[model samples]
Target: MKQLFSPRADRLLRGFGIIGAAALVLAATVGFALSRSDGTWGVGTPAAQPIPFSHAIHAGQIGLDCRYCHAGVEQAADAGMPTAETCLGCHSQVWNVSAQFAPLQTALALGRPVTWSSVHRLPEHVRFQHAAHIGAGVTCAQCHGPVETMARTVKTETQSMGWCLDCHREATPQSASLVAASHAQFGVEVPPLANCSTCHR
Candidate 1:
């Protein structure tokens, strides 16, 4: 009634709202990108083990199969960690006297497991079965990268939900094989890749 509001007030409010929305979107996009980046997930960072075991020597130069150590890959959800006895089986003869073998020896002596740092680990809520992937002919190198070339094991892939979903969506003839194998092995129908139950639960 008294011309208290400027004619440009409504326009200024609308412009501020638009700019704020744009800024929020930009912030969210940048945040998502950063979360999905390798640095955030420690990809390509090598994990130090109690013993300086060289996958390059074992898997690359020596040509040992991954299952030689990860014995449960084809039968269990977990790709089992190699036991002290597994290491001592060869190191007992090869580098038995070396100080490097001390931990292995102590573990075996104490009848305790050696705690190896995990390089590739999914969230607790995500259930990954190595057996299913193996049955579908997914090689260890596919997910774990070229461990044969690595002196120390590192997470080479993101192994994120999006990354995993992308792989499942893109599965070719292997998808059929995976489904068949799942039915045969677990007696459950393979759900769609995007199904929440596929990886979760």
Candidate 2:
């Protein structure tokens, strides 16, 4: 009882001060990093898609090429969504009898697009080029993860700018050479990777 309050109060105040200082330091570091040109600090969380499409069934089991459904990847800046016809190719015959295929069939027959929510979306200002990345020998798994194994697609990477830059640095040279190599690896004429406008715009 001599000074039970004095020492305990002092220790508690010191502890609180230390925690506050640490929090300030952490926030400052994150703020500074984000202010840089790369704009990658305090990475955001990944998003979930609406429909649970299994890449394992389509990519691994059926041996479907990425371009088959994402038909615009090589030719366009964006990889377009699968058309109703694309889904009907398989579903119209096999899963046609299942209740699960009912909505798909209805959409296909009516010429309506599937309301597939995008799982990997960036900020409106952040420009990403699917063609450039694909041309660079960057596998789909690099960004999208090993989608071939996923029964339902889930975002596996944070998709932060830092992550993209790390891959770009590693694949830059390979991307340059991939265009020079024979197209036999990709089964199409290789595209060049020299245009900055191809990606930045």
Candidate 3:
């Protein structure tokens, strides 16, 4: 019985242990490499507007603030689109009858809301507050890209949970100036946080 149990069994066990460790190392290496990719992120396709409005003209040349159109981005969960009146306030005289603005004209005459689609749509499971980001001094450019420069807006940031958390982790006192600017601009506190409930329901 003593002879039956030998050093060979110990050697065999050690060999199996080495093989298992190697497999784990290989798997982890591959997984980490794959994680670096932007898997399942949106193609960032530009949503077709009912009317082709130039953000460049409004926000760039004209110097209209983001809050001018998205009136609620700094104070609410949903960044509300500008009302029909808000649009017509300027367009009623600016480009009142341009072919490009025909859709807007139709919406006005119909007395209906302009059906503008979202550029960066989040998942229903995820509850994002535009106020939090806006308060935290996150610029529209940070998430929406250089919308002021875009003729047709497209997705710029991944808006992924990991990406959001990364920002939270990096928030420091050095960036306090931005938060102050945002607060001054929006009249809301821009606290940097990485709390789970910040986004998730």
Candidate 4:
């Protein structure tokens, strides 16, 4: 048999394979870091709403509660958006003649709700209930930040899975069973805070 292969060729092939694997690992690490960055999650970026409603003026200065506009925050899965009628209830007495009130008035007359942009949104797979968190003694500022001081509502926290998990890990024992009662149907003891089923359902 003839010596068809050279030793140098085998060495070069091994070197290239090692370099390729190293490059792949580096790329994957960088990509994961970027994905977890605040810029990627739009943290601190204000969403543009149809109306420039100032939480600073309403909540901070006037001392309006979080539940005033988001009425269902205490009892529903969703923190409900305030109806146009809700805005007009007070603006109808104050800024009724201002040009800024035009859109609100029109929405009220048309019986259509004003579509406001959401500041903090989670993935569809994540099942978060505002009422449960509120009932557990978590304040609006905890997840939403100091919203009362913001002129334009922005996402203060990343609201990422890891971020949520960190809070759950540190939660008091009394507040730990966020969904334990609901998960009773599973027939097995479910770890309340850190379980995938607790939030993924």
Top candidate on lDDT is 4
State TM-scores per candidate: 0.76, 0.62, 0.65, 0.76
lDDT of 1 by residue, 1-201 (tens): 586658799688889999999999999999999988999989988787788888999989989988899999999999888988888777768656688878887888898888889978778999788887898788988888888998888888888888888788666434564354343214544445545656777
Q: Quantify all predictions' global Cα lDDT against the true fold.
A: 0.80, 0.66, 0.73, 0.83
Instruction: Count residue pairs with overlapping backbones in model 2.
Output: 0
The residue ranges of model 3 lying beyond 4 angstroms of the native Cα positions read 1-40, 94-96, 172-192
Positional deviation of residue 50's Cα in model 1 after best superposition, in angstroms? 0.3
- For model 2, residues 1-201, the per-residue Cα lDDT tens digits are 476568889899889999999999999998876675232332223235344467899998998998899988876778998876787777767665666656566666787887777667687866777886677566787777777787866666667665665554345444544445423324543233333333355
Instruction: For candidate 2, give the lDDT.
Output: 0.66
Residue-level lDDT for 116 in candidate 2: 77
Q: Give the least accurate 10-residue stretch of model 4, judged by summed lDDT.
A: 176-185
**Steric overlap count per candidate:** 0, 0, 1, 0
| lDDT by residue for model 4 (69-108), tens | 8999999999999888888788887656688777787787
Among all windows of 10 consecutive residues in model 1, the one with the lowest summed lDDT is 177-186
- Name the lDDT value of residue 16 in candidate 2: 95
